[model samples]
Target: MRIAIAGAGLAGLSTAWLLDPLHHTVLFEPQERLGGHSHTVTAEVDGHETPIDLGAQHISPTAFPALANLLDAVGLTQDLIPVPLSTTLQVHDAATGRPEVLLAGPHTADPGWPRTPVLGAAAGSLTALVTRAAEWETRDVSWERSLDELIEPLEVPRDHKDRLLYPLLASFVGCDIAEAREMSARAAMAFVLRVPPASPDTAPLWHNLKNGLGSLTTALAADLHHGEIHPGRGVDHVRRGRDGLDIIDTRGHHHHVDRLVLAIPPGEAARLLEPLAGTSAVCAALGTFDYVDVTVTAHTDPTYLPADRRHWSTNTITVHNGWSETTTWYGPINGAQAFKSWTTHRPQPPREPLADATFRQLRLTPAAIRARDVVGQAQGDGGVHFAGHYLQDIDSQESALLSAIATTQRIAPDSPRLTDMLTRAPHASDPPEKG
Candidate 1:
């Protein structure tokens, strides 16, 4: 049996890794590299060089089972480092230069440095405030609703509303909370709050690879054998064949395979299979999914923002007041003192220069995001299959890998080769709703 897979993103590669050997697998990658959204690019920050992730960064240890397995399989578990979550969020406050820390989750000792003078907020009062924040979160409030309710009454001195709330919301939803869908808001808040409670004494754990995410991709590809990959080939079209699937590449080459895996974005897959014979509602529903653009900035300077150790007057903050195109934040990486920040959730369609510049000031902005439209249509059935996080409720490197592995299991159930590959346990104890 021969299997054909399109796109070499994490999901596509995962599928190939799982199905190969059992079947003669061929992978199509339009790009020269394999990381896809799991990207880390280098940029100069204040004359120093640093590596920053352009796509997915900071994976919570609790949320990614497949990622953990992949890391262990590649013997890169030692490269995983936990990034602490304590920091001071500063906002530009009028009259009062003092910034305040918008602390949530569990109360940590030494709330780092006070962004503004410690409002004399007592321990019990602080706990109650955090509990209230959690309550609003658990109820699945849209960021719009939560921000309106949480920001309006707080008479805290400083630009806390814009500096703290806005950026946090933007990073979560990849769009401004005001414009974000209620469902997206609920999901983001729920995910963030679910992080293991962190105390000043006990550091919160957020893990990432020390050598960069590329290390994981390179390792997986190597284990899978480099011969399976076909670089510089874009999937032009796909159709049902007598045995299974007929894949047409950009170069007009056709290959017959027992199974075809459309691991591209939903939109791209939908377009390719539209000309094919059968289609499913899943594909049509994919057309309705919307996406926002994210711009990434890499810097080596610990000046504007210090390393993970010291708290800045204003380090990571969210802005939602008035009308802003996107939400943004700044953070430090592990093993190095470099700092980087990005603004996400700005529309990606082409826009004017002023708008682009304002957004890019945060290293990422609406203009950079809007320039490229994300494909949302993914449709297929029977002989054909589709994979990627865009069609599902969550999109991330972890999700992509999970989808690929799961899809391959369904396509080739009796493959003995996949037995040695670790089977990942579901992260949530509760079963996920089936689509």
Candidate 2:
């Protein structure tokens, strides 16, 4: 079978890698390079060129079995290095103009971050809610409530919810607290509960590649012997015929294939699928998703962090002000000489004076949340499969990989490698709700 995959992100690459070698596979990417948002760049630090990931970084070794297995298959397991699970969250008090250190621990020690009385009480209430909700989650009935609706019933003080709980949830989706409130309750629960436990003496739970995530893509690309990768080529239109699928590139080159996989964002997918029949429902579903642009800056300045060096853990810092909450998270690179800081904000005009190093990222908004059944309905008819982070309603490396695996299996159900990988992969398990 001749298969054509769109977008050279992790999903597209993984699809090509897992398909049977007998099939003719080709990947079409609009960018000149691969890896989509999993990009890595080099910065000169202390007379040495060190790689820093300007895009997606960090993965949970236990939660993301598909990615772990992929690294093993590609012989890049040696490149995986564990990062400290500890974090130092700075909760900014708007009235006082000072941020309080909620959690502070080095990568090696457990930081018993304390919560305020109100916040602690609120946490207990939320735990009870989740415990009850879990029973509903396993049943046939739907529990598709927004985060805001769930919080509304809780008796916690508004201050605590806005300051602590909301900011924490906002960080999960890379959106403001107000926006996160609109997110599905299930998604917020999944993200928050998946976070590894942190203690002063706990070992690292998250891992990153020694050279950056780009190395994983490079390795996957190299392993594709039977497929062709067309960089700098964008698919302008996709039309399904009686026999096969037809794809037209920006340069007007025509190609035909027996099957097609779209690994790009939903908006772009909606545009391409609009011209094809039996895709209206899927296209309209794609159009329902809302997106925001985020900017991450890498800099040598530690001044942007807290005054005390002891509180400089590579965790998230959340600034709370009612509904408009912003999170600032950092990752140390090149022995702490440089760091990457990410800011999640609503779309707006570009700021004048770019940071020393910056990368712009696109993410989903809360309105995009849908029940799993709704997602199933959006899976367009016959040979056209959709894969990417948005499919899962969350943006993360693990989400993207899992989406790819699911899409691949849907297309090539009989492929042994793909089937075996899925069978052995660990399912996403939620952590015990905190009281």
Candidate 3:
């Protein structure tokens, strides 16, 4: 099969990687460079070029082994650097205007004092809900309920929910309180449960490529032997024909392929697939997914963090009512206070001024939760498979890779690579126990 993949992000690249050697493949990317959201930006600091990921940053080897396997396949396992296990989380208290610190180590947070009792209760409730939901063969009930709906029924106090529980859940997915609440119960629960509880004995909770995530994409692209990558060539339109599929690029060039894999965002896919045969329902479903613009500013300013250096130990600082910005610790890139501030939901300036460069991304809203089934239905349709972060409610490197694996499995079941990838991939059903 001559497979044509649109969008050269991790999903497109991974799909091409799995399908190549078995089938002739070609990848088209609209941007001049590949690695769409897995981008890494470099800065000259102290006479050294430092790599800071302005896009997808962290990876969990224990939870999402597909990414680890991919790194191994590309000979980049040596570049895997473990993130610091000893960290703190600063939850900004709206009323006091000061941040409350939650000490995190390895697999769990040291829930102290007022937060202890509430945190215990919330964790217990979430575990029960997630466990029960996981056991159910049909998640229709969980899927229909929003995170807010699921948490409202819990017996925790309103204050605790506002301060600790809600913020914790929101921080897990990198969304604000409102956005988290709007998320589907299943989507939120799946993300929350995937995070293994902090364990003192565990080596490290997360890892990142020493060079950057871009290296992974670069390696994947380099390893492709049977595919032609056309960066800066955008697909203008897509329509199915009796012969196969007709793809017209923005350059007025036409390409014919036996199969078409859309590894781009849903909105882009919808625009292209709308004119195709028997795809109106799918296009409509894709159109329903709304997106929020997020701006990530990379800076070295200590003012971006709390006044006390002790609070700076925290990897993530989530503001209770602030939807515009979420702070992330970049672990001292180039001897500077490296951090990325994420502004979500609405257009606004960074909560504080930034001294470094900023990168913007369009992320799916909680509304995408409702369209998950539709995306699956479209992917199941033969010949055309959709792979991207939008397929899953949360957008991350892990989800993007998983989406590609799923698309490859659906479109190329006979490929030995697909079987191997699936065999090595972690089972979503068997989540690790939280401490």
Question: Candidates' lDDT values, in order?
Answer: 0.53, 0.66, 0.66
Question: Compared with the true structure, what per-residue lDDT tens digits does model 2 show for residues 1-435?
Answer: 888999989888888888847467889999998998888777765676767776777776676777877777677666766665454556766678677765444455433433121123544554555564464456523335677776666676676566666666666445766777776766666644455446524424566787989999999899877899999998899877778888898879888988888988878988998987777777777877766555666555554456676566665454545323222233432253666655434222223212433333333435465523455665646778788877774567878888887877777777766866766544233222211
Q: Which candidate wins on lDDT?
A: 3
What range of 10 consecutive residues in model 3 has the weakest lDDT sum?
A: 110-119
TM-score of 3: 0.80
Instruction: Tell me which residue pairs clash in candidate 3.
Output: 88-314, 107-197, 107-198, 107-199, 108-198
Candidate 2 residue pairs in clash (backbone atoms < 3 Å): 109-200, 110-199, 110-200, 110-201, 111-200
Q: In model 1, which regions exceed 4 Å deviation?
A: 42-51, 92-167, 200-203, 301-310, 313-315, 318-332, 343-380, 391-393, 416-418, 421-435
Q: After superposition, which runs of candidate 3 have C-alpha atoms over 4 Å from their true positions? A: 85-141, 171-176, 198-204, 332-336, 343-370, 380-382, 392-394, 419-435
300 Cα displacement, candidate 3 (Å): 0.9
lDDT of 3 by residue, 142-251 (tens): 46566677767657567555655556556555566667677666665654456544653332356677788999989989988889999999889977767688888877
TM-score for all models, in order of appearance: 0.71, 0.81, 0.80
Question: Arrange candidates by TM-score, highest first: which order?
Answer: 2, 3, 1
Candidate that scores best on TM-score: 2
lDDT of 2: 0.66
List where candidate 2 sits over 4 angstroms from the true fold: 92-96, 102-107, 110-143, 198-204, 320-334, 344-375, 378-382, 423-435
